[model samples]
Each structure stands twice: as structure tokens, then as C-alpha cells.
Target: MRDAEEARTQPLGPQGRLGRGSVAPVLQLLSLALFTVVLVVILVKVSKVPSYQERRQEKQKIDKEMSQLKTGIAGLCRPCPWDWTLFQRNCYFFSQSKRNWADSVIACQDMGAQLVVIKSVEEQNFLQLNAKNKGPTWMGLSDLKKEGVWQWVDGSHLWFSLSNNWLPGEPNNDGDEDCAEFRGDGWNDGKCRVEKFWICKEPAASCSSP
Candidate 1:
């Protein structure tokens, strides 16, 4: 009886005590899952590296092309009629002959040119310096459309305020002096019918845009 009781109290084989779990298999499975996640991350990084490299290479190519274009542009042929007096990168034709402002503009157009269109501070200064010394000279300015509001001959809004403002009480719009002229270190209304030296301007290239 004692022997039988001792035998029954003894533990059964390992299979009979399966309720107790082993950590080894669980640890191995978790390690495999973590390894799989790490492998995916590495693959994603490797896949993106080539794209980054390609983008960098494309940027470099663009930079190189821009540099080459700038270098080549420097030696590009300048516009024709290089003999024309170039002031501030613009060619000007100061009329030695006297003509009314409108007639002067028409003359310029006849020559495939336009009346001088002042565009910059340096240009205005240069024009003032190079113009006739004593007598008033007709410029590209006009107020025919809007009596008080002045505009360039090309219908562009005038921007040369500081360089060219009318002398105080000068642009009186007196019936006779409807045209404008640069005189007495400033602008003044003048007779468009009055013949006076004028200025003509041409594009660097005779080429017209479509």
C-alpha cells in the first residue's frame, strides 16, 4: 500500500505535464518575426537610395547645362548696326534735322525704328547729356490722349519721374504747346507743330517677335 501511494504521488512523464510552457520556442519565433521586420526596413532603404542618387545626378546635369548656357551667351553676336550709338545698351538716333514730335516719330518708324523710349535712370541721364545743348529737343513723351497724364510715344506708362518732371508751371497745356520737350533741366510743354531735333530708337536686332 505504501509503495502504491508513493508511485501515484510521483510526477508523470514530460508529456503529461504539458501545461508548463517552454520559453525557447516562443523566443525563437519572436526573433524570426523581428528579423523579418528588419529585413523589410533594409530593403526599403536600399530601394530609395538609387532614386536619391538619380535625383542628385539630374540636379548636377541641370547645373552644368546652365553654366554652359551662360558661358555661351556671353560670346553671342550683338545686335546688328553695331556702329549705332549705344547708350545704356540701347541704340539711339539723335535727329540732326528739325521736325515736329509726331513727324519725328513717323520718320523713326519709316526707318524701322521707334521714337526714343526712355526705360532707365542711366538712359535718361545719358539722353539729357547727349541732347542738344541750347534749343529744346522733342522726346518720346506725349500727353495727347490724357491732357495732364503723360505717356511714352509707344503708349507705355512713363516711369522717368525723377529724371524727367516738368518744370514748375511749365506744362501749362497752353493751346499752342501740346507736345512735350526736355528743356531747362526739366520737361516742358511745347508746340508739336514746332520743328525741333528729335530722337529715334531701334531694337538691337531688326528681328521682330511673332
Candidate 2:
């Protein structure tokens, strides 16, 4: 009886392996459950990557449909493509993908458009608001031909007096920043090779139906 009593009162050492009342096994089980829950969450996110991509594609399609022109018997009005945004009779394409300056120019050309040129104060204001919401975006301005002589993609010189929308002391050409981007404040010189979203501009497309 005394031996049994001593065993019952014995301090919990390594030899007193987990029993019903021991908290060690319970803690271990709780930790395993927590790990399982975290692992399951991670797996779920990984599995939904494709679904996220599909959802983005669907959203783009919906936007295109919503902006489509109304069909009429005599559809002679020039309108922007369903995917492009229209402003002041001009159609603009804000790229969803990021690319280097040269690649961005190629991308716009491929779409039968060119990188945007700020032709007026109205267009500048419009883009200022657009860029403020979209983060840093590349424009058609560059000084690749001659440093410090910025020109639009169309070979026209930038009129700084009329469109002096530079972010104070900008176009610094730091680290060979030959390309220009539209920021919240205005334009800034950026590295030509750095990947960034771009803007493309073109005349409104003529839509006709037989």
C-alpha cells in the first residue's frame, strides 16, 4: 500500500510518461492541429491561383462589354475599341502588363497605336488624374536620341512652357533614366530598362455595320 502511495505521489519525471492527466500530450496534439490548419490554409491559397487569374480575365471581359458602343443601323461614329478608354475623341490603352520602355513601345505599335503624347492641358489634366490613381506609368516621352532633349514618341519636341508638369527638379537622368513616367505629381525620368506599366494613344476607331 505504501509503495503504491509513493508511486502515486511521485514527481513527474521522464519515466512518468504521458498519462491521461498529463498536459504534455495534449499540448503536442494542439500544436499538431494548429500546424495542420496553417498547412491547409496555404494549400488552399496555392490551389486558387488559377482561379484568381481566371477572375481577372473575366473582369477585363466585363469591362470591355460594358464600354462597347451601341449598335445602330448607320454606325458611322468613330469610337474607341471596347477595351480602350475614350477621352476627348482619342482612344487610350492603359497596359495591364509591365514592360521595359522599348518593349512598351513595341507593345503599343503592335496594337496599331503609339505611346501617348500630351498634346494639350486638358489631356494632361486627364492623365494627371489617371496616373494619380494608377501608380507610376510610362509615357511616350524619352530623350534616347539626345540626353536632356525630351521628345514624344511621334518625334515632336516637348513644350515645357505649356506642359511644365515635372515633379520639381525631375528628369534628373539619375542612373541613365532616359524614359519618362507619369506619376501623381507629374512626369519623372525613369530607367529605360525598368519594367513599368505604359499608356498608348490613338485616334478613335471608325465603327461601321452593313
Best by lDDT: 2
Model 1 segments beyond 4 Å from truth? Answer: 1-83, 160-164, 206-210
Candidate 1 per-residue C-alpha lDDT over 1-210 given as tens digits, one digit per residue, 9 for 90 to 100: 999999899997777665446667888999999999999999999887768779999999999999999977765665646446765556777777899888998998998888888787777777777773746888888888877777888888777564336678877988757777877577788879998888788766543332
RMSD (Å) per prediction? 15.6, 20.9
List the pairs of residues colliding in candidate 1: none
- Predicted structure 1: lDDT: 0.77
lDDT of 2 by residue, 1-210 (tens): 999999999887756676666787889999999999999999999997778779999999887776664433245555987679899889999888899999999999998999898899999889878877888899999999999999999999999674578888897999999999998878899998999889899998655565
